[model samples]
Target: MTHTSTAQTTTDEFIRLGLDVLDTELTAIDGLRRYIDADFAHACELLLACTGRVIVIGMGKSGHIGGKIAATLASTGTPAFFVHPGEASHGDLGMITAADVVIAISNSGETNEVLSIAPLIKRRGVRLIGMTGNPQSTLADLADVHVCIAVEKEACPLGLAPTSSTTATLVMGDALAVALLHARGFTADDFALSHPGGSLGRRLLLHIHDVMHKGERIPLVDESATISQALLEMSRKGLGMTGITDAGGKLLGVFTDGDLRRILDQRLDVHQTPIAQVMTRQPITISADVLAAQGLKLMEDRKINGLFAVDADGYPQGALNMHDLLKAGVL
Candidate 1:
């Protein structure tokens, strides 16, 4: 029979226990700020000097954290990946090479599977970086560099579970990645290159010209065109708006589908009136080279769903609507 702790039977006691776990972790993180030393510096330098990819290896909980760290590093311009120590002993060790730097993770620093292949890693002339709670562990002693991720207490109430230790290890990994990112002078553009399918990549990759409907495909009419003619152009282009331009292609104003509906509701003469008289003046426009994502923001910010692409001299060159943004996945 399992012994039940009477103290944990109450809901308030359970809540306090949960809060205590978070408190311990928060306190440990706070202390980590001042613990930065030469080891952290050396880890960053070692990774910077690496000529090949980083091969991260760990077991159990550390393995999960290692995978995430590898993914973060890879996405942030550092090429790294996780490998299971158990699988490495079988055949995955072939993936390791002399040019690569190995990051070994184990809280106890004495995992049998990890230590079993430690010799082969060194034999292959691979640099080993150990992350562990114990400073004097065998893994640390055999490593070229050791990053201590020690925690004062476990967040687990049982105290035997990995909690604060894993958090500290993850923090150390992030610290290394950010340090390397700055050292390499990694920029947003570099990050966008790796995340082409993401919204951020869309913002960086797309420009106004790419989405803008140009040439005769754009809904456009001259200032002299009647409201009926402007409505026809708007319908033909299906952009729900028509731009008014002069003989020199300079934009004068815009007539939108909303304007047409409003005029019709008031029983205005569409056939007898000129579009220039009723057009919206000083309309919002964007440059062809402006980012499509920025164009989308402009539309949202100004409470408009469409924009006219204008030249440097304010001539209408292209047009786009919210549908274009949706198609480009910028919305």
Candidate 2:
């Protein structure tokens, strides 16, 4: 009864099309379960036994998938790289070594560039693992190990584009990398080591020292400093809190904006009142090596908004506030 505009119809059609593509890919990966033949195990075994690296080679769309798999493997504790099959004939094949394992991928299993290097890879004493839709094709026939990435059909309406086949290949590569990761006892720390420039790295590698203000820049004062002096220090450092230390430089308490408000409510004179009178005694402090996320958790659990960084002798050495977390993108 309703007439939809062409734009709206196109929008709906594309959304449905994308969902169909994802569903088709899921089904293809599920189908791989039945093909759990010895060929798959043999491929993994050859890669695991390799002494050097896993070199991935493919052409066209399959080449794109191979490149992504290579990057994934490289970042996940497995040494790998993608060498375009087209480039292998252009002198880049010299990058290949006898100690490497070769993974050749093709949907038709007869890509000329990929197949051309199969014999050379074998002649160099490298293990050849093939991922293909056709188990009987030339590339698979020449491989020492064949992995079937057969898809029932393409997500494309005409079954022309590579949708399900690429998904199956990616899933297989992930399986290999994760299995090898567990075999090598790779950990989250190891992952952080490989990704030290990203936010995930910052979350894992950052410590209190990296974010907390230290030295004279820290917001700190002696117990004898007046409330007015502490507030000045807090404002100067912009951390919203000041650490109150004893005569021996040991952490005695902390004074924050909250404490100031409470003192003001009691009509306390800032200029004459000693910071010790309004400071929170035995305030929660963190060590220099504490993680930023852990620090956030500690503050949240304690119902506090700030922290003092302390040393081995309970002496305050640095100060941090909620704003610091926000600035560091940890909030």
Candidate 3:
């Protein structure tokens, strides 16, 4: 017989434990595919028909997942909020209305705090949707629709803690949120409206003019300007590039740091070289009203770090670089 100390355990043994846990949880999630039938469809229907917010309630570990589910629902065009089941019996149950749908989460379907308010929720005529591991428990029996998140076993080696179960619950919640999102024809713009404080909002809402430098701040010079003058303009504006415009202010070309590198490689005299001789002709430009995200994509596709915003007639309106997008939270 062989014995090993905890410190002497090989790396392979430690990794095997982790891989086994992951395999167990993955199998648990796969098992849920069977439950995504009629009951799942009905659950989406119930939530889609909800006229008011979805009130999510659970105890302990379930509470944490409930909070995340509620946030996902709210952000994806469904109105929702989390209410502690313990607080519900103490009068928080009043927060629920007949028009609202209540989603109660309990692993065993026998959590006393949740069951305590089940009768109250039903008495008020609010639709109840129960998410539990045991479909035969009191919570499931009383629910209008039950979502079974039963896992074969917990990922925990002890077979006691909520591991695979919680992950399954979260996946089920995402399924509900996304199903409702599609049924409601929710668009990315709608999503941005809900997440106005995040980068997504900026990506969807910010326009070129909002982030681009205009007027004096725009690095511009006439096509006839010396390379030395172009460098001075680029340095003063700090955009690492300068736009060359014609007599009527229509953009003709652009000189960038890359062009400077090319000139240096060719040993051209920056002091006396003409800007028009080295500038990139009819450079790719973006519309001033387009989303900043489109501008970033254009810059990425063109393999450049900066670009000029133009009007309908191709006259330069503003200039911006990758840093501008970063500064405006549009990147």
Candidate 4:
């Protein structure tokens, strides 16, 4: 065979192998739907009732999945953390308390490291939820509740490495976390509290008022002010827009760089014309109580770069630009 033909054959085999792995794993995950039964409910109940935390324990690949499960639980309103079974046997067992619930993951349900620490966990009277592919395994029989992550077969061609089994276990972990999340009436705001350091947290929890320029930083021009004065206010504030307010400080209109362009096109005298005549009446605005993400959406959808945070009475309380959202991690 030519070199090009050999290379084509190799690439085709790789694609075939990858698709086979995915198809096998997809079948395994789909089979998990039936396992969300009473036993799963019991596990979720045990986790929800615990006042302390969910202690996830496993060995090897199971340990990696357990860590992710613990993180998902914690971020979704269930206080949980991972404890390596080997470490637990040595000293980390102290972290598990009677108020805490244990989630033990083992493909065979006979992992030595996990089984070694099982007795100590049992002695503490902590609730144990076993996640294993083997329902008949020792870990399953010993637990207060068992969640079967049993898969028909491993996606690994040799059946020696974990592939389908681990995916099923991870999906089972997600099911447990989501069940508890809904049971506890968890909201996006609640999820945001645990994830305050990330983009998701900023989108859900950061409010417009948190990032808006308030007080003197808000570019304001009197309705009677000349267009020249409005330009000076917009430039001084560097927000690309200025709010035109009445004598009582209630917002009347908005003059923006775009509005200035229109006036320039009309050959209107900036020095002779009043800002209100050139301003956009009933301009789009947002409330301070809304999230900064919503503010970003409003600016994007309206095809504008600047916005005013207004009160219910149409008074401009603050001003913000796209730069503010970017600076506050809300973009």
Candidate 5:
């Protein structure tokens, strides 16, 4: 009993510590609101007006956060990259040009590696923006614009680990990236261009024409085709559905496996019953130019498993099913 109680107490203590850390980090982030003044705006303006890339440099934990910040900025329409402070001193400093803007990150504002290269960076006539905990430190003084990320205390119990400060820095980076993203009128289409291999890219860049069955692959039958003939087309095309069209190739209605199941109990004569008699009238159709992702949403909203891509004149142009969307990675 005593051992069990001890285990329970330890679990409770761990939960409390985790909550305390979250609270501390949240407080630290809230404290940054006061520091988002004119200096932050100037930094954004400088970055926006730059003709060259944005260079991010830092040391230790700040380096990891700086790398993420740089990636966020680059992916959100701003051209940016990360350069280690230690590497900048050796040879990577050549990557920076006079047309570029450099963002230097250091919690103490006195990191030797970062401070060592500050003067050289300034000599290139490049604009320098410093992010540090100290507003009056040497790095802040050397910087043309200083953004203070001071926190009341570290979330680490020992007060040594970079916990709250790093979180604040990352949040500040996101704020800058998002502000620039909106200012430049960056659209989802632009974001998809950079993330073509991702799920968002598939959803935004892929259209119905890219994944739908076309020409001979479309499961379709004449409006006068018997229900048995429509079923044969459905089976042959393997899309679990068939569209009923008129002699002029205009879509009239649709019949699916679900409809087949429903009519089975009604004892409908498959050999003589006209497809248009049992087919769903004016079925939901999508345009070939519509995004495949929107097609998926339409199917889900209407609780369907298949759809036909039709022309503006209501002629069947292509067909697709949920499986096609899954294969296209839009699912």
Candidate 6:
């Protein structure tokens, strides 16, 4: 009983500590609003007008944060990359060109590695934007534009770990990247171009034509075909559905496995009944140019599992189903 009571007390203390850390970090982030002033705008303008890439540099925990910031910027339509301050001093400094803009990050604003390369970076006639906690420190003074990310206190109990300050820096980086993205009128299509391997890219870039069955693969039957013939076509094509078309090759209707089940009790003569008599007329059809994602939504909205891609004149061009979308990674 005593051990259980002690364990409960320890758990409660841990929860309290976790909550306190969250509150501290929240307060630190909230305090950053005042710092997003004209200086911040100026830094963004400089970056926006830059003809070359944006170079991000930092030390220690700030380096990790800087790397993420650079990635976010690059992915969000801004061309940016991270270079370690220590590496910049050795040889990576060659990566920065005169037309490029440099963003230097340091919590103390006095990191020796970062400060060591500041003069050399300036000598290249490159614009320098500094992000630091100390607005009055040497890095801030040396920078052409200084964005202060001062936090009231660290979330760490000992006040030594970089907790609130790093969070503020990351948020600031996002703000810059998003602001630039909006200013440049970056579209989802543009984002997909950079992230073609991601799911969003597949949804945006893959079209019905890209994933649909074409040529002889499309499950199709003449309107005059009997229900049994339509079933044969559906089976041969393996799409669980068949497009019923007229003699002129214009799509008239569609017959699916669901239709087969529904008419099972009707006792209709499969060999004698025409497919057009039992098929779904004016069924939901997608254009060959439509996005695969849009096709997925149409199927979901109409409670369907398959679709036929039709041309402008209602000619069946191709066919696809949920499984095709899954195979294409669009699902």
Q: Which candidate is the best by TM-score?
A: 5
- Name the candidate, 1 or 6, with the larger TM-score value: 6
- Per-residue lDDT of candidate 3, residues 1-331 (tens digit): 9976768768999999899999999999999999898999999999999999999999999999999999999999999999999888888888999999999999999999999999999999999999999999999999999999999999998988999999999999999999999999999889888877888889998889999999999999998889999999999999999999888888999999988987787878877888999999989999999999999999999899999999989998999999999999988
lDDT of 1 by residue, 1-331 (tens): 8987665367887798889988999887776775478887988888899999999999999999999899988988789999999999999999988999999999899999999999999999999999888889999999998988888888887889899988988898899899899999999779888889877798788899999998889888899899989988988999899999888779999989787767776666878788998999999999999889889999999998899999889988899999999998888
Ten consecutive residues with minimal summed lDDT in candidate 3?
A: 2-11
> Candidate 4 — what's its lDDT?
0.92
**What is residue 6's positional error in candidate 1, in angstroms?**
7.5
Q: Select the stronger candidate by TM-score from 2 and 6.
A: 6
TM-score of each: 0.91, 0.87, 0.90, 0.95, 0.96, 0.94
RMSD of each: 2.4, 3.9, 3.3, 3.0, 3.2, 3.2
Error of 5 at 199 (Å): 2.2
lDDT of 2 by residue, 144-256 (tens): 88888999998887899898888898888888788778877888878888888868887777777888888988888999999899989988988788888889889999988
Ranking by TM-score: 5, 4, 6, 1, 3, 2
Looking at model 4, which ten-residue stretch has the lowest summed lDDT? 1-10
- C-alpha lDDT values of all predictions: 0.89, 0.86, 0.94, 0.92, 0.96, 0.94
Q: What is the C-alpha lDDT profile of model 4 across 133-181, one tens digit per residue?
A: 8899999998999999999999998998988998998999999899889
Clashing pairs in 1: none
For candidate 6, the per-residue lDDT at 196 reads: 94
Off by over 4 Å in 2: 1-14, 35-41, 296-305, 323-331
Candidate 5 deviant stretches above 4 angstroms: 1-9
Q: Write the per-residue lDDT of candidate 5 for residues 1-331, one digit (tens) a residue.
A: 4544434457788899999999999999999999899999999999999899999999999999999999999999999999998998889999999999999999999999999999999999999999999999999999999999999999999999999999999999999999999999999889989899968899989999999999999999999999999999999999999999999999989999999999999998899999899999999999999899999999999999999999899998899999999999999
List residue ranges in candidate 6 displaced over 4 A. Answer: 1-9
Instruction: Indicate the TM-score of model 1.
Output: 0.91
Residue 47 CA error for candidate 2 (Å)? 3.0
lDDT value for model 5: 0.96
Task: Identify the superior model by lDDT, candidate 2 or candidate 3.
Answer: 3
